[model samples]
Structures are given as C-alpha cells and as structure tokens.
Target chain A: MALSPDDVARLARLARIDLSQAELEHLAPQLDVILESVAEVSKVAADDVKPTSHAIEIANVFREDEVRPSFTAQQALSGAPVKESGRFRVPQILQEDE
Target chain B: MSGLVLQTAADLAGLIAAGEVSAHEVVAAHFERIAQVEPQVQAFLALDEERALAAADRVDAKLAAGEKLGPLAGVPLGLKDIFTYQGLPCTVGSRILEGWHPPYDATVVKRLLDADLIIVGKVNMDEFAMGSSTESSAYKVTHNPWNLDYIPGGSSGGSAAALAAFEVALSVGTDTGGSIRQPAAVNSLVGVKPTYGSNSRFGVVAMASSLDVPGPFGRTVLDAALLHEAISGYDPMDSTSLNLPIPPVAQAARSGEIKGYRIGVVKELGGEGYAPGVLQRFNESLALLESAGAEIAEISCPHFTYALGAYYLIMPSEVSSNLARFDAMRYGIRVGDDGKRSAEEVMNLTRGAGFGAEVKRRVIIGTYALSAGYYDAYYGSALKVRTLIQQDFDAAFAKVDVLVSPTSPTTAWKIGERLDDPLAMYKADLCTIPANLAGICAASIPVGLSSENGLPVGFQIMAPAMADDRLYRVGAALERGVADAFGGPVLNQLIGSPAWDALSAQAVAARFPNIILGLAENLS
Candidate 1:
C-alpha cells in the first residue's frame, strides 16, 4: 500500500523523530517501495510456521546475584549531553500549571 | 623488522613469542603504515596512538618478565567504531553519538586486549550500520585500497580496508546483515560471521539486536581464525550468548583439509543478476573443491529468495526499537534544548538534527511496520519468513556438510553509483543474509579477481551452527589450492599495484569534493 505524507508524519512522531516536510515527502515513496518489496514475505510464510524472535535457543539466563564493581555515578554520567547534580538533566517534562 | 606490517597475525604472533620482534615494534610498524595510507583510504575515525603504544609496552614488559603472552600477542587491530573502548569515542558511524566516549569496554574489546592485540584505532562504518556502503557515515568516506573511485563494501568497510591496505593485520567488525562478509569479499580479505550467540554483544552498538554479531577480519584464513578465537565465546553479560565451548577453529584452519566433505551449492544465490566474473570465480572454486575429493551437489533452497525481503522488514523493525535510547536527555549531541522547551520537543529536535537520511528512513519504515494495523503484515510475516529460511538451511545441511555461494552478487561499484537507490543497496546483502537468519556460521574468503573489473570476489563457505570449524577447513583448503594456482595469496596481486599507490597519495576530498565539504559544514 502507498503511504501518504500524513502516514509518514505519524510514523516520524511515533518514532520520536521530527521530519521536515521535504523529508517526509522524500521518505514516503522510498518506504512504500521497501514495504511493497518486503510484502513478498506474506506469500510464502505459512500459518503453522513459528516466528523466531531470537535466532539462537537460550532460556532465561541467570547470573549470580552477588554484588560486583559497577560504574560510578560520575562515569555513568560522563557522556550525558545535559547533566546536573549527578543526574541527567532534561528539559522540563510537566508544564508550570499542569 | 622491515615490512612488519605485511606479516599475518599468526606470523607476527610467532615473531613476538620468539623474541624476534617486540610487540612495541609491531605496533609502531602498523602506526607508520596507518599514517602513510590512512589519508587516502580514510579507514580510521579516531586513533589513540598513546594508548595503543602503552598497551604494546605492557606486552613487551610481560614478555621480559618471562610470562607467556596471549596467542595473538603483538598483532595490531582496527576496532570498528561500534565497539566501545573506554575513553574512546563510540560513534557507531552516526552524528548522534559523535563524541560520546563510553565508560566501559565491549566484551570483545576487552577480550582482544587480554589477548595482547594492539588496537590501532576505531574504524569507520555506515551510519548505525544501516547502509551497504560506508557512504552513509556522517564522517569521512572510506575508499577501497584497490581503486579509489570504487567503494569498499560496508558497513564494515573501514575494517576491511585496513586489512587490504596492510594498515592492520586483523580488525573487528560486526555482521548484522553482510557488513563483515561483503566488505571482506570486495577487499580481498577474510571475514567471518560466527554462529549467532557465539560472540558476545555486550557493548557493540546494536543495529538489530537479534542479528548483530561481532566478528573478525584478516587477510588470511588462519589469521581470521586466530582473531576469532581471541574474541568469541559465551559471555554472561550477553543473555543470548551460547554457553557452549568455542569451536576449535584455529586448528581447523591450520589443517586446511576438506577431503570427502559434501558441499552444497544453493540454487537461489548465484544465477540471475549475478555478475559474470563473480560466477566464474565461484564455479572455479567449486571445481577446485571437487578435484580435492569433496562431493559437490546442486541443492535447492526455494525460500532463500525471500530472505532479503524478510531481512529488510525485521532488521529495520529491530533498528527502530534499538535506536530509541538516543534521546536528547542523555549521551552524545543534543539540539534545541532551550530551557523553555519540553523534553519531548528537545528529543525530536535532537533526533531530527543528529540522524542521517538513511537512518531516518529506516526508523520511519520500522515504526510504520510495527504500527497497529501493519504489524502482522510486515514484522510478523517477516519473522515467519525467518523460520522458513532457517528451515531451508536445515534441509540443505541435512544433505550437505556445508554450503557455498558468492559472497556478493558483484564486485564493488563506484562510490556514488547506488547512493540514490536504497533498494539496490539492500540487494547487495542478498547472498549473505540467509546465514544470519539461520543463525549459522559463514566466512568469505577471496576467490579471485573479477575478470571484468580486476576487483576481488569472495567465495562464501557456510557451516551449521556450532560447526564453525568446517567453514575454516573448507576455506583454508580453497585458499591453499587457489594460492597455488595464482602463485601466491590473491591479495599479493595488490601489494605493488601502481593504482593503489597513486590512490594512497590522493585526498578523499578530491573524489567527492562537494559532498564531503557539505558533510563537513553540516557537522561543524
């Protein structure tokens, strides 16, 4: 199915990426081509076939619950683009009056 | 000690062990080579000369104290930018993580260090490992050492180019789709994608969590096997890592015998759309194997045709989910973060500014595929198709001990040839994706030069999961047989080529003048 520009915009929002109008227009047709090409999967995949999430077979893996040396707060926050008081600082989440 | 950069990893290890050369000398030789050729090849994104020399010094000190060094001691390596090395940038070839230095090392990085391999630098890749060529990298474009005008297939292009240029004997690369294998194929190097879960992914930046696997590259089969042995095995840090003992691949590579082995040629991989020169080399390798007493059979994997289509759907779906962690609040570059703006706005602005066109395209496609109405039609069906592809492998392996195919459909194209067409780029991985979907081991070894372009073509050898040794044995045998036919290793043809020397002296800006300047301006 051909994706409309509105559909592309909705996807960009869902993905939390802000796409310019030109980007949405450019990507819509490419996404449509990719989507149509990949639609071939529907032709051969049988109903009984089990979908594979992880290619390898491993069950819930457990490690010892013993405490070990972990990254210090400073090290953990080193790469943060915005940090304050040993925490990741972000733009305000809630509005002033809300 | 002269020409030390040209030695194989195994040979260098032997030299280091026997006290013929110090690890420091080996590391210095590689750094010299890098300084010479890196300008032309554009293989490295970042180089920590002090850190690499310090690491090499430690190895020399250990040897002086009479302590036995690791198996691959003194071999210089190029670490792909995706794998984190503490205090070094882990950009994963995207502007989103441009100067983000990780606090910890990737499991593979630590393992390679413990084995005493001096890491020369972090190499370039396609942005977030998204594209077939390194053209999508937000940084410099990596040129194929053989010819500057053509690409070194990616997203492991830098790693492959490093080996081809003799800048490093070994390098680490991740194969989410054909990243490792395809680059190695075009560059005339050896690349391995171990069975899924065989290598830990603790700190390698995830492109597709289910498909991302860190592997090794070398100019020779045994060299790749040695590096593979150093980096692979189960890691508790990675939940999906297999807990079984790593296969004895180094020994198998040394043995180089595949006598009486059953080799199956996949009917789907190499007929239509395959370049003539690629097919010729592939058939010659098959004939060589048959003459060596191996049984060759034509096997049909009908579902293989759909593997590429399935991969595009599933890989992007996982890419979208995996890449969501790069919000503006933490890590790397943030944009439009005025105090008055909301966190959501800042995130959207940062993502919009940071991610490249290819990355944005995949993310949108993935979001649409996983959206409410399209999940079953796209992502769900892709998963089912993965099962069908795996089943095809199971049926094929039941008849043959291993499978063989062309690593890629053709030789490397000119740098800008496929930039406008994403679908054409995706088709480059068609021959290599089925093995990833099946969770098996596959390696690409240089077959011969393409008669058409005089560029290298790789012959892929695949073995069942946990049967990785079989791939090495067959690959080594083919390498030995083909080396004898060609007078020496296939890469030997590239050693003194005037084209390589001329390309090495030319600046990358000269090749893509306007585009690179535009990228530089954007980054600034």
Candidate 2:
C-alpha cells in the first residue's frame, strides 16, 4: 500500500513505459491512494473463498479447422508503424555488441 | 433538431417502412441538424456524411424494390469510437491510435449496418475508456446538451451527449464499470449494459475484457431495446460470447407491464453519500412503481459495497494485459523508433509518449498489483471479492424478480470538478459496478431531474444474467408512469428545470430547446 516514487518507477519499467521523473512523482501518490482504498478487499475476503477471474465460468470453445477468408499481408501491415518486404519492420530484438 | 429527426428510432423506422419518408431524407435531416449544432456540443469525433447518405440511398433502394428492411431501418446512429469500423479512424480517445483505421468492422458495427442503421459518425470517449468523465479524451470534451457547463458522463460521454443534443436518435456505447449507465443517468437518456457476452467483442477494443460490454443508448426504453436486439446474439469470433438465443428485450419493452412483479430496492446502494434530490427522485419512482401494481422492498446485497474497490483492481489488471498489444510496431502511431535503441527501449519510450496520464496510471497500478509478492493481496483478493459479488446477485435474484437503485448518487457535475481526484470520480460508479462484476444485465432510465443541481438523474434496474428482459419490463412501465406524471416526454420535464438556466433564452429562447435549440441561435 505504501507506494514510493521508486516503486512506481520500477512498476512503470516493468510495464514497458518510460515515465519522466515528474510523471512518476505525480502518479505515485495517486496510485498509492487508490491502492490503499482497494486494499480493503483483502481484509474481508477469507482464504477459503474462491477467486473469480472471469464473471462467468469459461469452458473451452472449439471450432472446426476450416480455411476462411482472411486479411492479406498488405492489409495486415496497413496500420503498422513500419513495414518491409511482406513483413513487419520492428526494432532489432537482438544485441549486436554480444 | 427538427420534428422528423427528434422522433424515436422505432417511429422513424415505422415511417420509412410505411413509405411515408425516404431514408435519404431522414439521413439528410440528421446531417442538417449536425451542421447546425455540432460546434457547441462537439459530440462527434468524425461525421461520415458521404457514407451515411450512400447507406441511406441503399435503404431507400431496397424499400422501393418492395423488399423487407432490417430491424432498425433508416435510423441515423452514432458509434462509440472504441469499435473497429473498417475505413474509419477508431481512436479510443487516445493519441496512440490517432490516425489508425482498422481493417475490419467490429461484430457490433457489422450488425448495426445489417440492421440498416445509418452510422452518422464516430463519437468521443475517455482515452481507452479509462475515466468516468469525458475530460480524459485526447480530443474535445463533450458538453451536456441540457447545460453546456456540465460534463456528459463518460467514457461513453459522446454517445449520451449525441442522444441528448439530437445529433442522432440512437447510439452505441460500451459499459465498463459505469460508463454507459452513469452517462445515461447524467444526460437523461436510456442506456443499457446488457449481460456480458450477450454482445460480441470480436472487433471491439478491449479494456477490462471481462467487464467491457457494448450496448445501446436511446431517448426511450423501447428505442434502446430495439437497438439492443439489433446487435445482441452469439458470435463465433468472440470466444466468450453466450451461445444461447438473445433475450427478447424488445418484446418485453412493448409489454410495459410489471403488475404482480416483485421489484427490490437495493438496501446497500442508497442512504449515504446520496444527494437529497436524487433520493427524492428514487423514492418517488418506487412509489410510482407501487401505484403501477408492483410489490417493492429493500433487498440487501452486502458485497455491493466492495464492488468498486474490486473493480479498480480487476479492471486495471486486465488493462495492463490487454494494452500490452499497443507495442508500437504492429500497428498504431509509434513514437520513439530512432533505430539506435533496442526494441524494449523504443517500446518504453513510445508507450510513455503515446498514452495519456490516466491510461498510464491504471496500467502501472495494474502492473504493481499483478507483480510478484503483491499479486495475492491486491489482484487475487479482488477476484475472490468478484466471486462474492456474483453470489450476492444470485441470492438476491432468488428473493426478487428485479433489483432497482438510483443509477448514480448525484447528477452530472461540472467538467473539471472531479478531474484532480480519481477516488472521488470512482464513487460515481458505486451503484452500477456490481452488475458488471456479476456479468448481469442492467439499464439506466431517466426518472427525473435532481432538485439539488437541477440536473437529470437516472433510475437503474438490474436483472439476472440471461434474464435481461426483466429490466425492460419494469423500465417501460416506469417510463409510462413518468410520462403521465410529468405530462410530456420523460426528458422534456427537465427542460424548464435549473439546468436549463445555463442555456436560457436570455441569450436566445428555444421556441423548443430540445427541438430547436440550434435555431435558438447565439446559445453560449
């Protein structure tokens, strides 16, 4: 519940967002206030209680493996930030220095 | 807004089907109204006038051929921007998706088109549907038509404001927490958050996947129900979609009879933190229902109090996971891909620059909550609370046919009033969040204006999962009661109220404010 600015920075890093120092300070106290309130849930719920991640019971749904009309590669890359020859152009995932 | 455009979706469809008016004329009339009033209201993000006219021409062509029409034929509609609509920009009010046009239509969009509903434009919303007020939108803040000074409730603010301002007869909105119902309550419209999974989420943007539900908003209960039926049913595209037949909401709405029905007033939702005027309107509605030959009583669902707390946890946790897809490269606007930085560095910088403050706050909270050591205390406990809330609904449904409450504790507030305070804004959803947690059906119908602020207030009705018809049965009856008691259109009663003082004729009197406010001219 006691979320310091450092902790918020760590969390933001984990979420893959590079927050400025000012944004971290601004968001930290607000998130702390929210966490303090929502922490009330932990107080009353007993360990014996079952958790519900989804509102309704989700049974697995299966479908026939049939070929259907699908988006072409051009259409799929239409909204992409960068594209190359029939593929997406993402930043390099590997380290060259290694 | 003219006489023809102000008519309900059902009435417009009737005229079109009866060969009285061409769909082109109806569509043109709405565009004329939009041209007149859009500057002040700012309800729509994009208006597809060219396509809307073409769609109308197609509908008229079918009618001239003596062919049967779609369920809601010829009515102009506003779509919430969260859904994918092929060539149209689907910005969920976030800069991250600024110029991105989805390649396909959401299942809801496809159904609306198939039903022959003309989509006039894409409406505004809170960025990623994260905020209660529409202020968090990357675009303009939509003003409540009743009074331009007040907020149109959000993240479905534009949808509600569109209906109130007569920009469109019916519109689509998705409720996560209280987005649809709260905005409906504050704006004086009929908004339904149908049973989760009743409407598919195939091409709809995901926030909190389990709780995000697309539904209909209209000026009347019957209109909402008609729109409801148009987009409700099973879809193979949405894996969690209900395989059962759509609940007969439209048919039940026409019944307008809750005689011999058991209606329960939720005990925990009221009495504290509720505005005095809101309580008065709520109590009067209870009495009105009693006079209509229904039995009412206080029903306690003890877990209702924890629903908001549980929701913030569960919703944000899902937000963290679902929004992970906006990683800069695949689609949407990318910020910091200078080529020297690694993929993770570019992603962090891009997400930091692209997302708004509220979206970042929730995603960070979500990441913290779901992180190691903290997961069990926050997200895990919230899930157990979710199970408890559902059990509470199951027990209450056994005791009563339907549950009723004041949709919001108060009416619409000024735009910036709660912006600085996230916790205070979250309380606006106390009465509506439980239904989302349980995946049950609920609706908010305008009962009266709140005397405290002279703003519109909504009466909420909730039904068990798959029993959504019960909400319509009671809502229609009460709507009739309010009409007779108030002596005109249900929303018309609020026109002369204090909220009208903001848009009064001291500037330019409406020969008919709701009808001719645009013609009123010089309106501030």
Best by TM-score: 1
Candidates in order, TM-scores: namely 0.96, 0.95
Instruction: Encode model 1's per-residue lDDT on B31-69: one tens digit a residue.
Output: 777767778888888887787889888998999899998
Per-residue lDDT of candidate 2, residues B280-390 (tens digit): 999999999999999998899998989999999999999999999999888877766777788888888878977999999899989988999989999999999999999
Stretches of candidate 1 above 4 Å error?
B506-524
- lDDT values, one for every candidate: 0.89, 0.88
RMSD of 2: 4.9
Q: Supply fnat for every model shown.
A: 0.89, 0.87
Report how far residue B318 has shifted in candidate 1, in Å.
Answer: 0.6
- Assess each model's interface with DockQ, reporting 2 decimals per model: 0.86, 0.84
What are the per-model numbers of colliding residue pairs?
0, 1
Q: What overall lDDT, based on C-alpha atoms, would model 1 receive against the true structure?
A: 0.89
Best by lDDT: 1
